[model samples]
Target chain A: MSMQDTASSGVALWRLVADGIERGIADGRFAAGDKLPGEMEIAETYRVNRHTVRRALAALAERGIVRAERGSGTYVEAQKLAYPLRSRTRFSEIVGAEGREPHGRMIEASEDVATRELARELGLKTGAPLVRIEAIRLADRTPICVSTTWLSAELFPGAGTVFAATRSMTKMLEHYGIRDYRRGATRITAGIVDATDAARLDLPLGRPILVVDATDLDLEGKPLVTKHSRFAAERVEFLVEP
Target chain B: MSMQDTASSGVALWRLVADGIERGIADGRFAAGDKLPGEMEIAETYRVNRHTVRRALAALAERGIVRAERGSGTYVEAQKLAYPLRSRTRFSEIVGAEGREPHGRMIEASEDVATRELARELGLKTGAPLVRIEAIRLADRTPICVSTTWLSAELFPGAGTVFAATRSMTKMLEHYGIRDYRRGATRITAGIVDATDAARLDLPLGRPILVVDATDLDLEGKPLVTKHSRFAAERVEFLVEP
Candidate 1:
């Protein structure tokens, strides 16, 4: 349903109707835990056949988004993953704790001028030189997520070599006189998968995805690295507190 | 690009290609600041025309996912948000602190038998009665996300009416002499929207979505509820800690 293209296929009308219904939920109209209208009602509302409506409803049920009872009718699903937003936890730590083998492989690394946005996060100026590291972390051999980090390039000129040879970025930073990086701030959002991600994660083209944008600071309130991570939803989870 | 059902219109294939790239970053494959493969390389890799690849890459640049230097080629986007993790924060509390209005509207309230999955979260028998509530919380009238919650029916028989009236199941629990509920655990993941969620959130069918699964606990470790929230990619974000 996230398709920006038109519905031109010879797909069933119910499937199209179902697409409309799913979009409503994603867009926050129907909302979570909202009960859908009855069959006759939905059929009328969507201007589709009752059978088509039923098919849509059936699709909802299969995803565990809703449930139906013989006489009680149907209802929205009740479920959530309460990912704590209090403090940032490293993906390696959380994924490791979950008994999954979490590994990060350096995909690319370099030093470059910080753009205006990167400069803000690092408290530097636009075009300020910064060290950048990009890696793909995985559970076992299967690719799961990706991350790229930016730091004051002057402060970590040799960061790429360390990342390639080390087990932890934090550990390497410590060796480079960064005993600790104070917490700065974080941002989380959702987005769909682009071409590169779909291929790496083996997901279907244009699959929806979860994106987390995070930044860390040093003791002097200097930005260490701005990290953006994207995850294939079906494969990974954020273990959090509330 | 979130459309797994295939497109029927004359939409550009380049758009879909761009979506795929965005998907890669989300999965952490194309980490921030990482340089993409050469344009011609991407074209060959994706089996698409070079022009199509250029358009897709251009889109990423427009979204701030990457930078295109005429001579050097395109680069990955640096991190944007300063995300604070390693702590705990409440949704309503945090959203308010950000100067964003937090509102909750109950969408459904009912009592029913716990399914196998529900019983596992609430530590109850599979057939035990449970009260479920679905609500959509808006930040500034924008339907940012949706959540569904469940509680033991035996402990909260007034759930249906109180939730409907108050529009906040969390507050209603407070009225029942339940002072504070601790979140025992949370899980986060990402995926493309299913049919129903696509409808609820008003997204295109099969669009990308963020899914969160969580469980709450009362004092003395008494299981309280299991909740699931799904958000359209780009609608809202989850916080870990600050």
Candidate 2:
């Protein structure tokens, strides 16, 4: 099961080393944005020469598993957090399972009239007042997602105050006497990060972001909230289970 | 409801125009990479002035929904094709459901010994012979995905030939007496396109690509084939339905 064990096969030593490093990445031995070990260290670990380690690093770079800076050592490209979308999915639990601390910061919150699209999504009439909560979510202090969530203002009158106080959606919903909600439909698209999101996410311009348009429903199947989330694409991977 | 009908609401006219145009993009009235009509035309359609239309377009540009090309008007940024990843998802059917033609081309097909990663994915011993199929898929002649698939060579011999003849994975499986197969786990990540895929997908360098690592399972719940597909992130979206 080790990368070195596969070297006995006909595959090149460099490839095996590269594959091993990649496996390390996939399994989280090497975190994204973390500087890779020095070439001498890798060579020693793999029982290979520095030249072979160099070749392996090059291959990894070509595949975008890692990137090399002119002066800095090689670093894993981005975090690939396993994010699962399920009925009872909880953001805090998901990040916790990955051994990372999850933090949410409220950027802005307001009560506004729902736009036509928002009304249709939340099953509210046009011009109905809604509470809009904008927040940035971070995994272990690394900003990863910026989301805007809208709920019926009439139903969740103090939603903004609750969210700002708790910094947790699930907790905020609990304060509304609703303890159970499930994911409805999730639509995942991608786009280049806009300026505002780039600043919020601390991502460079032109980086791709995964746009998630999702709905949450209460125990009675009534739409509870409509959320628009933009995830730093490189930092997370969605795991879809049947 | 039409965008013009929403004008009666308190929202500004320019904002209404922008929302309408965005809706048009979402509903496929305008496709990815398609240039927008002239300002005069858009104004006429929305019953607005040229200045109002210009402001709307600018808003769209700021949101990354569309990009303005110098002297050539504005263009819809990219197509957002809805791709559902289900127990029985098919590429051609998904594309066709979106009112676009689906085409597949075999870039290369060969018999190769499975590497460690490939062996683990296909549940085979390292060095086991396997058939590798590399293909590019398109929607209405717009390249969208490039995938590499691996099957146990001993179990399904000449899979490449069947695939070349049918241009369909479902059909290829049929030739191997697999009347039905379902999707297993799917991992979705995003990265910038490399040079080879950029050319194959007719995309510019640095554009984001969705990396989908998936498995096909036979009726008996055995792994059949493993697929690695890279999609033009802007052209397609994955719909995960509960």
Encode model 2's per-residue lDDT on A173-218: one tens digit a residue. Answer: 9998988999988888776665478789976444567888899998
Q: Judged by DockQ cut-offs, is candidate 2 incorrect, acceptable, medium or high?
A: incorrect
Candidate 2's C-alpha runs over 4 A off are A1-79, B1-79
Best by lDDT: 2
DockQ versus reference, model 2 = 0.23
TM-score of each: 0.65, 0.74
**Tens-place lDDT digits, model 1, residues B93-154:** 65677677877787777777988778988999999998878877766665656788888888
Whole-model alpha-carbon lDDT for candidate 1: 0.67
Please give the RMSD of candidate 1 to the true structure.
10.3
Cα lDDT for residue A161, model 2? 91
Task: Report the number of the highest-DockQ candidate.
Answer: 1
Question: Ten consecutive residues with minimal summed lDDT in candidate 2 chain A?
Answer: A1-10
Clashing pairs in 2: none
Best by TM-score: 2
Q: Which 10 successive residues of model 1 chain B have the least lDDT summed?
A: B80-89
